[model samples]
Target: MIIRTQVSFSVTGTHFTPSKVPAPFSDSHDPGVIGTVGRFRGAPVPYGSAGFEAPEKEMAKIAWIYERVSPYKSAMRDAGAEHCTLSVTYTYDSQCALSFSQEELKMIVDLDCYFHVDCQTAT
Candidate 1:
């Protein structure tokens, strides 16, 4: 069976960089493409309807995407390789610092955060 691991966390503060849209109406449009949407590489910009919004909106998007991408992240880590991964989830209640509360916490300011894990790598 295909094994998958999931982790949930909260976000309070975040950093978002906006990018310019490439291929405006073309089918091959990638906002993540550095310089195409924004400047510099290795940076993520807000996408979707709220593309040209504020950082807060982008941060909210970040939390949303992270929530959707499950298992794949942990699965990759288990294989072992020179890849970038962050386990800051579940440990951080907010985006700025590493603080978690026993009670339900919001991922972003005024934005509700939800998480779920399917596999267990450690207690």
Candidate 2:
């Protein structure tokens, strides 16, 4: 069972700084060679990211952030970013199944962003 889930969106590449990626990002940092929790590294520039998380709600977390970024796809690409992504991570206590509905996948396709999902057993 999934104990918690988080969904985040990011524009990252080796060319542009976070500042160049435009506004509305909740997290930003310079890239590093080694990655740490919540900090994406090794791009040599910066990562601009934003996330949406809610406690105890059943609504899909990805929906909460979709509207905010959907309109900026082109602008973000114009910022010299080589990639835009929607990353979902699930923390589970028992079984963790990696699956997605067609609608869920369509959202990612519409945004032209990579979809990355990770599952971890709760310790």
Runs of candidate 2 exceeding 4 Å displacement: 17-22, 29-58, 98-101
* lDDT measured at residue 45 in model 2 versus the true structure, 0 to 100: 31
Candidate 1, residue 89: CA error in Å? Answer: 20
- lDDT by residue for model 2 (1-123), tens: 988887877777665455555556676654433455543443333443333333236466665567667766666667656777778888999998767778777777887877888999999
- Please state the error at residue 71 of candidate 2 in Å: 1.1
Q: Model 1 compared with the native: what TM-score?
A: 0.20
lDDT of each candidate versus the true structure: 0.28, 0.66
**90-113: candidate 1 lDDT, tens digit per residue:** 222223223344321443322222
Against the hidden reference, what TM-scores do the models get? 0.20, 0.68
Error of 2 at 25 (Å): 0.6
Best by TM-score: 2
* Candidate 2 least-lDDT 10 residues: 47-56
